[model samples]
Target: MSSGVEADIALDAAVVLSLGMNRVLGRTAGLAGRGAEALAALAAGRAEARAAALAEAESYDQALRQVLERNARIEALAETREKLDAEVALPEPLRPEEQPIEELTAWCAATDQALDGAERRLSERLAAQVAAEIFAVPGGAEGLRADLGAPAPEPTENETYANETYRTLERVLARLLPDATADDRTAVAEAARLLAGIGSPEEAEGVITEVRLRVGEANRRTEELRARERRRAAERDAAEQAEAERQYVLGSITSAFEEMGYEVQDGFETLTAGEEGAVVLSRGSWPDHSVRLRVDDAAQVRAAMVRTAPARSEDDRRLDVEREREWCEAFEAARERLGEAGVRSEVTWRLAPGVRELPVSDGARQTGTRSAQRERSREREK
Candidate 1:
């Protein structure tokens, strides 16, 4: 009995120990699994935190750009509203029904156009100002220190076009004309004021001086050109007047020659181009001599014809006078081209009327025609 009791106590103690061991083993396994899961969750949380930080950093550039764009839009809207008000006047008396409906409609349209234009201008200006602040002021000061007109500071790649164009302009101008005159120096200083649309005293002086010089030269050239034109016009008038007189004389000479029954000689027209309209003349009855007209063709021919005076037919004297008339026309045409005083030549002729002489020739078409016409006239008269 004592042995059985001892064995039972030992067995009970072994079972209790096994149960406790099994519980401890199960608890240790569960704790290990839970620890692994906690480690995985910690790693994921650290990664998520890092990703969030990266996203925030990336967004800053976009945010800053947005703020600048918003500021520009606000300024543009404000300027547009003001501009529209300025351009379109309200109805007179500021009262209803005082203005025409058409005028009111036009005003509204003008106001809207003005607003649009102003908005565009303001947008452009705001963009410029913002860019200037960010780029021009700082970059320009650096340039000023680096001999102002030297090659520009190197630009950051893709870092906006900002002041690059202005910098490039200065660098190009510096190279294009390295050495400058007083005028060039003045141009440079004035260029800034002009670009900015600011009325500067120094710039204004340069402009005024340049304008004065140009205006003075313009006035002088204009006066000289005008004087030359006037002289040419006067000469033309005188020449035309002389030509008129010459034509008159030539007409008279032609009529007188035909009437006098004197056959016209060739080379007569050639002599008309000469000074004083003189030509050499000779005939079967007259000695060779020079003849010209004083008042051109008309006066000379009229003198020769002497309309009121009865014609005296003498072949010798008539031939001499006819030769002189041809020469005068030649002289006048020459004088017109050269525009100089013509040399005088002595040419003489005697005039005779048409009635005293009669001739019969196969060559004289006028003689036949005149005779026929005279017969016709006689018949009519009868």
Candidate 2:
């Protein structure tokens, strides 16, 4: 019995030991499965954190690149502004401060008004300069104004510089060319009109040159015409003076001859009196004698006596030589009578038709005196 009881106890102890060993093994296997699940969860979290860090780093790089690009664009805009300033020779525009959009807009509007005012002033100055240069030319202001078709309007308080200059030019032209012809006035008016339209001084100079040439030509023509008229007047005056001298000499001589007891016939060679009033003389007592007298402008006198041959017979024509001697004596007595009457005379005689002058002898003069006395006695008896 004791041996059997001991065997049962040993068997119970072995079974209990086996049961405790199985429970411990099951608990250990459960702990090992829980540890492995915890490790897998931790590893998943680490992987997620690493991915978030990488995403953050990429976003920062993108932001930095954008800022750099914006800075580059601003620098480019500033460079362009500087280039514009240099090219235009303009002062730099005021930069706006960090302000509200409304305030900035107001500032821009004010700046624009200021720039407009400056532009107006500059234009006025340029116009004044051009006008001054044009006026500096000789007779330029008057010449240009005359070229204008219409008279310049009176100046007004608000008139532009260009308009004021045009008015001044018109006045100058009026004073300078007061006697201009219609054509010249028209040309000047046209030129002035064109010059008024010109904007620059250079263009005005070209027009002035052309206008001056036209005016000079017109003046020269006028002078030539006046000279021609003066010459004609002088010629007429000289002719009138010469004709008056001739008439005075002829009248004096005709009256003088009438006082010498002779009938005066036509003047010598001409029907009318000439510069020297030469005349024919006839007396009833001297039927076959021919006498001529001449008076000069200086009142000097000369006389000539001639004899006529009888055409009825050749013998009478041959006797004309003796009659010519008697005529020569009568001419000497007539010369002495004229000298006593305040006229000095030169007497000449021709013996025949083609004969020249010859002097009378003292015997011929005595015969002529006897013939005159006989003619007086015969007249008294009748």
The count of residue-pair clashes in candidate 2 stands at: 11
- What is the number of residue pairs that collide in model 1? 26
lDDT by residue for model 1 over 70-126, one digit each (tens)? 333344355443642323222221122223435544554554565455544443333
What range of 10 consecutive residues in model 1 has the weakest lDDT sum?
1-10
**For residues 76-159, what per-residue lDDT tens digits would candidate 2 score against the true structure?**
334433432322122334332223335544544564555444433332332233344445566455433323434556655654
Question: How does each model score on TM-score?
Answer: 0.25, 0.35
Q: Which residues of candidate 1, in runs, are more than 4 Å off?
A: 1-203, 266-382
